[model samples]
Target: MKDRPAFGDPSRLTTGAKLFLILSAALLPLALIAIFATLQTSRVADEEARARLRVAADESARSIAIELIGDMVALRVALNALGADAADAPSCARVQGVFAQQAVDGTRFAVLDRSGRVLCGANFALPVALPSDQPIAAAVVPGKGLILAISGKRNGPTARAFFPQPFLATLGTPTSRSSGFSSAIVVRDQELVLDTIDNAGPLDRMETTSADIGIGDLALRASVRSAPVTSSLIVAMLLPLLMWAAAAGIGWFVVDRLLIRPLRQLRASVAAYTPGELIDPGQVRALPAQEIRELGDTFRAISRTVALHEAGLAEGLVRQTKLTREVHHRVKNNLQVISSLINFHARAAPSADAIAAYASIQRRVDALAVVHRNHFAEMEENRGLNLRAVIGELSSNIRATAPEGASSVSIALDVDPFLVTQDVAVAVAFLVTESMELAMSCDPSAQIRVAIKPSEIEKRAVLRVVSRAFVESEELRMLISSRYGRVMEGLSRQLRSPLHHDPLVGAYEIAVAVLGRD
Candidate 1:
């Protein structure tokens, strides 16, 4: 997908999916590596198995060969006796029987004469019986010690042949069986070599082998299943899987916790900041580590830059307000001299327009005086002005700004008991009182409502003034609108504040957001 908005997309991952992704990305490759390494280890185990089998087969082959060759050599002594050949026939038979008894296990000593005839002792059963014309029997040869190759295949039909002294335990004894191989021996060259067979196979399966020591049991040989050719492959596969599962689990838990988890937390923290809700150690509680502390310090620096700009604006307002206060004071003094001059000239003017103009000059001067009077009068020890006191004085001063004997210009103060800066209090009271005075001049019967209330919705103080005075007249409306913006802005600067205007309710609101106050 090229892109899809996060809010509505079905494919977008939930928290669980995201965490699984984190785990897989960190763990899966490690699992692969572990599996490969384990397989390598398993190959070593397999090699050892083959080596153990080789050693066992070699030991059994050599042991069987020695037993058979020693038995065949004894047969030579019995044949060499001259008296043993004549009237020693019964003694010869007894001697042969005694020697046959000495045949250890599968080693059945048969004394075959020069004609391959079973003369005095037992014949070992060949797996396949040989014809009378055959030179070598299943495990016997014509000459000296030689091997009767036992095929890896199961032996064919077998028959039991008894010795003069039979092996009592027969085929079931420990000496009868060998590890991973089978054994049998038979007499060969009348009195010469015997032969032993480890494994005999069809011509193709019998790996052609040469004998080193020319004993009666000529050669030792055993066939081992080739590596990777048996069912051991399944073990090879399972060994790696088991080792990988165990190792990958250990790696994921240890490495992810030690390395990946902290890095992810840091990534989330970095992404969470908005324009206003940036890093606040007061909020996140210092991240709790030396490394995160350094990161947080960098975040704090960015936060402080915005704080500093806000502080600079506040400081600028303080300076602008101080300068404005000086200008207001000088204006007040200049207006006072003008008011005195107006009073002097009112009697001198003959026309009614001239007298009304002089009275208007005096009223404007009194309005300016109301601002000065509010700022200078009874400032609090905190160097801040009280909104209540300023409102009270402005109401009282309105009586002064009124036409002669018009005490009917009643004022209603709905202000909450909220405090403000001295310069802000003075400026707001001046503008509001002047607007009320002008409304009064336009309509003598006008009922003015000046209200100061804490706005629940806006979470600030609001100033609302409404007058029906000359509301239809373009001149009075324009004057009201123009001064409304200027008054609120000037008051905000004077108080080092931000103002919100609500034209719908005819309200001007100021947020007394003084830092360090809270």
Candidate 2:
């Protein structure tokens, strides 16, 4: 059995041979398309040539007709002169003398009676019969000339102009004759050629087109002829297609060397780029085009600069994060120290009112310290303070330091995973502490609920504080009717939103902006 060719295997063919086959396949269809387009163009050019030939033929026929019509003008003038003088005497002799004087070349003019018998003319022998009831008529006489007859009125004498061969031949202009178009006077039924401009080519080998033009009773046939389509004409048309294919191949080869190959190498280099590593320009430095080599060099310089700048920025960020953590740690320690100093002073105070004041001051300070600790904890990711962690820690610290009567107050937290700025967290902590303390003061067994829910607005959350003591206790209302109301209002203004109070639901809601999810 014969072995089949391994067409699918790349290893069987050399790279150069594969490329040659690919290029041939690509260019073959382009050559075919070019040939078909050229042939269509040739067909359109042929149709346009034929249309031009028809126009030339028509113009030639019109030129002959115009000349014939001009001659009639002179004939009418002579006939009118003959009629105006006929009443004085037998003016036939004088009319004939004037006709001979005015005549040009072999042109003849005559006056005919009602029976078509010549009354006065240079040539009186040729007597013709006038058609009945016809006012004007024309006819071409073979070997003689074209005859035109006109009359003034019915049964009146007729005026005739005889245009001979020499005069009629000269009517076909030299401009028309030289353009390969030929004009002839034809009698359609008789199939006769009375007069014609010389045809340039033989009748059989040429393509011919004809148009018939009528001048009175005479008909002119205008004809144009050209050589038929042949092998030489086709060869002449195909030369351009061959040249176009050669040009396209040359252009593709030039672009592949100058642009396409270099771009592919550059793309590979870019695809292999690493974040902190500089790209080497050596890969593209030997490219054929100066502009491409320069572009690669510029990219190398820019990448190196970017890599260096990024490294510097990373080092600076590490140092900045350490410094920020230390600052928050010191602030938190300072707040705790202040809280301890207040606690020590509260134990030594003689008045109960003064001790209560010291405890209130200590709670506010602890809330601030809790916010700073949480903010520092979130520094590694830089996602702002977690509201859930802050609220949970604050609720624990508040219950731990609850006043003597309010030691049994239960606090519940329903906080979402919302992250907020340090400033917003501070205000939120103060608002929660103030609400919890007011609820405890009204009823020591008060049940306090704090919820943080996502708001309809993007990157925003609603903080709702609820307590049954807020709804039923007149003492809680009186507490809010004093400085506590103003304090809540100031916290709301600090958070940049209004605090909404719903007495029926015993809940206070305020919207706060938050950082987006990790």
Candidate 3:
């Protein structure tokens, strides 16, 4: 006896399994692409996040340093008013008033002798020792404040300023502290941290960065915890794919209801159907969708008018054409809807960066649409796409659809006439679009030159994009290097070749396969 088929056999799949499998197969390529793109760009994203944190720390330190300088300048001016002669010192009441006006909140002023004794203006006890022969010294005493001592005339008199914990905590800008940044002021000579300002909540990992305060032996150090890389990568990779899955689920539901279910029912009826017997009108009326119902009625009519054997062949061909047309129409409609929604949101976006991001997404959608349209049109002929025409049209569309600032860019293409498969066309279009955008972003009026020449290898071509803006401005190059590096790498991978860069000449080159002439 013959062995029975296993559970995994295609013939054994139920309707739902078959439908689900078809959807999964359709989405497999897209899911793989999303994963690859995320993997390629993950390092860049992490680096950018850390770079932002460092910049925030540096800025916070600088702002506090400025405030410290203001306070020190006020102390010097007040001491000058007191006069260098110790015998003719101002009255304690007058001295207290001067100190009170000059001192900020959470701070105290005191006068001490060379023996570390309080002379005058000692309303509060000193937390740190008096200065030695050195002009100035700073020390941090726990639970009190930072003490800055200014020596006067060989231990005769010393002026000391006490910056308490509460006062020092409020030195930096409020923005950084609110966004999970904590900072502390340190006296380097004594290796002591005077005060810490920690307004941040729980964090994953605290990374500390330091900046000089520009005062004697003082430094400002800021710390912040970065978001978890694993969680970020997972979300980045899955979010769009989840959205795609939802859309696919809806499409599957529609197909099953309108087409698949009815076809399955019709198929059963046909299996039970006799050669001379007419199709059952009750089952025909029970079918969903007017198209399927009409299809059933046509099948019944054909069976009545023509020979049964020829009718069966004709019905199968017509059914296939109808199903293909219907599915294609739905897909095209869905894509158009997606494009319209992107346009609506892009226009309503609040910032230039958001609008530019939306534009970038829209361009990718357009690129896919272009490739699909060309592939569908050429399906009957089996001839490969015209690379020159596709690139020319794509270049014009990209230039016309560029974000507001890049409209004036000049993209000159020197593509030779060549035939290329759909895959090669897609990679080329994206590579060219990415290169031009890099040039345009650096300088709106930047001239971009694209040249595609036949390679020494038959059925292959080398593409080169040249722009002065890439090499002329260091700031622009640095800004786009990490951002575009992964994107260019992914495109080159699709072309099955490495992307070569000529920084001196501001040019990029890659080799890609083309269709050979018959």
TM-score of each: 0.37, 0.53, 0.37
Report the number of clashing residue pairs per model: 7, 0, 0
lDDT of 2 at 132: 36
lDDT per residue (tens digit) for residues 1-518 in model 3:
99887967998876766777788778867887887888668656556656766786677667767766665565554454443644435544455665575365766776665566555666466556655545567777865667777765543566777776666666554454535566667775544343343554454555677778777777777666555567777888887688668767876788888888899998888777776678888899899989888888987786565456667877997897667656655665676678779989998999988989888877777666666666665655668877777778778778878877778878888988777898898888888888887887777777899888999987789999999877756755675676777888999999999999887898999998988542
Q: Which candidate comes out best when scored by TM-score?
A: 2
Model 2 over residues 300-377: C-alpha lDDT tens digits? Answer: 887898899999999999999899899999999999999999999999999988888898888999999999889878
lDDT computed for candidate 2: 0.74
| Candidate 3 ranges with C-alpha deviation above 4 Å | 1-333
Model 3 residue 453 CA deviation in Å: 1.7
Error of 2 at 268 (Å): 8.5
Writing each residue's lDDT as its tens digit, candidate 1 over 401-476 gives 4665345776567766555664555566665765666666666656667666665544356566666663556655
The TM-score that candidate 3 achieves is 0.37
Ten residues in a row with the worst lDDT in model 3? 189-198
Q: Which pairs of residues collide in candidate 1?
A: 145-215, 145-216, 150-199, 150-200, 151-199, 151-200, 151-201
The TM-score obtained by model 1 is: 0.37
